[model samples]
Target: MKAAIIGGGVIGGGWAARFLLNGWDVAVFDPDPEAERKIGEVIANARRSLPALYDTALPAEGNLSFHSEMADAVQNANWIQESIPERLDLKHRILGDLSELAPETAVIGSSTSGFKPSELNEKGARAIVAHPFNPVYLLPLIELVGDAGACENAAPVLRSIGMFPLMVRKEIDAHIADRFLEAVWREALWLVKDGIATTEEIDEAIRMGFGIRWAQMGLFETYRIAGGEAGMKHFMAQFGPALKWPWTKLMDVPEFTDELVDLIAGQSDAQSGHMSIRELERLRDDNLVGMMRALKKTGSGAGGVIQRHEADLPKPEAPDLPITGDRKIPVSWTDYNGHMNETHYLEAGSLATDRFMELIGADANYIASGKSYFTIETHVRYLSELHAGNRLTIRTQVLKGEGKKLHLFHFLYGPDDTLAATVETLLLHVDLTTRASSLPDQAVAEKLGAYHQAHAALEQPEGAGRSVGQKA
Candidate 1:
């Protein structure tokens, strides 16, 4: 698919990175001469962080081009995103032009934070509010508000690129999330202006407190837990009355005076001026990846979004042995030596074994039927070092497969196509309830037999069945 980015500032660059990293060819039309450099930096950050969020590799990055003319950028584009400044007249003019030039089937998404779709389309344009948070590649939520048909068309496309399309039920100012954000933003400004909390203190209060809760459960769910066995109704009865109290200046707006700007900016500089913006972005991305990965375990919030999207990613295919595992080495998998930790090699092998099991019908359903393969033994031979970001591919060969026993050989190849590692494993079919060895199901046995026969013709993999410290 092709995406046209009508602007290439921070948000525009982020949209481009999100589309491009997901294997969509991106054409960017930004008048700024430095747009390419700026977007390249954003993509560089995305390339490091986005792939780390997944256990499997993302699709190969698509082509990127810079166009001087808007018409050239939108040519044959499937999605056209406008990320120009937030002026209504400017958006109207640009979106109007885009609707005329873009393909009839194209979906035009405006990255407007505050404007409603009705206002955007008033100038005879077909545009939807596709507001995404900063670092759009990693953040999954895209608030979509517009024509029902357009939103329906965009939702699947957004999902394909690993985004969560939240369809707004009605046209409202600032859509959904931003409305809540603006509320908190207003309160925070008041706190800063009224000598209550410094910028860093407020940030610490959030990152060290409710921000973590909000990341996983959001408002109502977390409060439900706080209800202490009585749930939301009881908690609301107790604390809902506090809503009338003047605990927050949520409805008040802090004047944007020069002194206030200087106070906040100066305090912020003191708190984090040592690091560059890129450094801060990297730190933020790393933290988000770690948090999101943790959430994946429980299918919480953005983590659940990632899990669903990963299920749809294409499985790798090989002509001989199947490509059971294909992914980039995330930074978290590394050790003090700046290379992939040894434990992860075994983890990768285990994942490959799981995939191989699924290939032969020993999948979730079969396991749920009280029959599954349990690894009895494993031997790993490390041939080369793997560093973070190196792509790893595991090809499996079914060495022996029979009624109750299974033997497999896995070849782990690094980015250079060199032999990085080898894992030899043995597993036995078992009844989960009894925890005892059992005969494989007839269907599973037949599938395994076919692979075993096909692999019989190939030469014995080197170092297979080798004992520890043995000579080659």
Candidate 2:
């Protein structure tokens, strides 16, 4: 799991943080003296944000080294991620060097946003266009297009690094992301040039509303939902007429002259002039991570991608009833109330248990099939007060899983690893379609059985449920 990142710019640094934090050894090569300082800032932001996006335990940070020589960085690495600036001959030279030094073992991935792999590999190297979005540490979509052989080999490698490789069946200039971005870019020019909207207003229009929906469900899927009960066919019948409107010229492409680039860049600056590039990027990454993780619960596109990642990832083999953490307070859980309110604390404990369940392998698609297990019964003993800033942790164990029910014991801890509360809950797998009491399928039963076999056997709790939760 060694990765060599050539040309350590913003994208290169992002790839470094992503691979390093995800338990892959990462070495970076960029002769620029400022590379260290710039990459360090990127990694610092990446460190705080990436881990917080997930409740499950992340892989340990792996080895990182910076080399002056490209060959030194490329050697012995399983994946060579290239993120140099957008210049064809420069990339060819580098790819030629990479192809010679580490030709067979590692996959050569280009961060080139626009160029096709065939054109890029004119120097006779097997390369895949692994075009990742700006913050490679977050946005999971990596537009991959290249030789079929290269893609076949690279898919599993990309997955190991927590990337979603959407294979473009044909070679096209600017690939997927940049192509869509170009459409917006063209229209945005029209808006700004015509004074129809200010640059900032246009961005706000996007970021504030429809932009949110696009993350979970992209354009076609979003349109499918807008179509109502009858779905896409109905939607098309209703709205397809609007395509002829003067509202848009879908075929228009803006000339990227100096005037246009400056216009857009000028507007962007005025829109976000208060923040530095680093600050803006950090804010962007944080927002993207939060939104994407929220979407992951539904096992939507990026969510489904994350769902699979959390499945293959390994967790520390702690005690069967291990107290992984115990803390006095965290600022996030506290509301305006001096004492912790009821719902958030339940949320916190449930989050901890959910992570535990994920560690034991209950994933989104598993829960999505309308046969999810839910907390059917619960008795919470809040022994000590919880404040806004009071840190808390929970200990959990499967007390029993008999027939269709699960008895669980949760011990909440505060400062000094002291017990704050004890919650005993019963869970049931109900048929999502029928909303009726139902036993879990054998696959789930076997997983629960494994947990039962791993832990010390115990009797069913006194209050295990024969029915669903009141809310359920």
Candidate 3:
């Protein structure tokens, strides 16, 4: 798949990175002489963070190209995204040209935060509002509006690239999310203008409070929980009258006076000017990845989107032995030493053991049937240091697989195929209902015997059957 990015500013560069990282050839058209460098930096940030969100590896990155001519960029593109300035005339001109130049089947998307699809298509441009949040590579929501057919076509494509496409039933200005954001923004501006809060304090008010709630559960759902036993109705009845109260200045616009600008900018500078823009971006991305990964455990909000996308990602093919675990080391796995903590080595080995169990039909279903393997012992030999962001691969070899016993050896290879670690594990087949030693099922035992027989022919691993302090 190929994507054409019409502008290479921050948002445009984000779009390009989102596509390129997802294995789509991306062609960017921007007259800015510095566009390439800027986009490259954005992609660099993306490379460091996007893959960290997944336990499985993303596809190999696709090719990226820059074009001086918009016509060249849009040629043969599967998707064309317009991200120029929010000027209607400029959008009409570019989008109209895109309609003529792009493939008829190509989905033309506008990253306009405020403009409606109808307004964008007013000048005979068949464009849809595929508005995405900032740092598009990480944030999953894309508010899609316009032609129903176009949106329906875009949703799967967006999902294929790990995005959540929300189709707006009505073409409202600013779509859905931004409208609510605009209201909050207006109230914030009033507070700042009235000297009720500083920029930092106002930001703290959001980030320390509702921001976290909203990340996992949106406004309505959060409110529904707030409703208590009676649900949304109880909460609404209690606080509904407050809606008409003069508590907020959302309807009143704060004048964009120079003094107000200085006040906000100065306060913001004082608050966070120490960090460079790139530094701030990396910080934000790290926080987002960590939070989203936490959410993945519960399949909440963005985490659920990631979990679904990960299920579709192709698993790594095994060589002679099964490649049980393949993944990037996220920052959370590192410790004060700036390398992977010792605890995670066992965690990785446990995951590999789980996968191996599945291979032998001792999987979730088998466990639910009151039979499973319980790890009784493990010995991990740390060969070398593994750091965060390193790609780790674990290959498993069955040392012994007989009734009531399963012994396995795992080879942990780092990015350079270096012998980073080795894990020797021993398990016992057990009856979950009785909580006692038991023989494996006939089918599972057959599969395990086959693997054990095949692996028995191979030479024993160097660290096999060794105690913790045993010499090499």
- Candidate 1 vs 3: which has more TM-score: 1
Task: Name the regions of candidate 1 deviating beyond 4 angstroms.
Answer: none
Counted clashes in each candidate structure: 0, 4, 0
Q: Write the per-residue lDDT of candidate 1 for residues 215-285, one digit (tens) a residue.
A: 99999999999998989999999998899998888767888999999999999999999999999999998
Q: Given candidate 3, what's the lDDT at residue 260?
A: 91
lDDT by residue (251-336, candidate 2, tens digit) is 78656689867887888887889999888987786677667777777888787877788767664445566443333343334457
Candidate 3 wrongly placed segments (more than 4 Å): 368-370
Candidate 3 lDDT, 1-472, residue by residue in tens: 9999999999999999999989999999999999999999999999888988987788888999999999999999999999999999999999999999999999999999999988998999999999999999999999999999999999999999999999899999899999999999999989889999999999999999999999999999999999999999999999999999889887789899999999989999999999999999999999999999999989999999999998898777464798888888887889999999999999889989998998899998999999999999999999899987898899999999998999999999997899999999999999999999999999999999999998988999998999978777
- Per-candidate TM vs. native? 0.97, 0.78, 0.96
Location of the lowest summed lDDT over 10 successive residues in candidate 2:
463-472
Model 1 poorest 10 in a row by lDDT: 311-320
- After best superposition, candidate 1 residue 271: deviation in angstroms? 1.6
* Candidate 1 backbone collisions, by pair: none
Score each candidate by Cα lDDT.
0.93, 0.77, 0.93
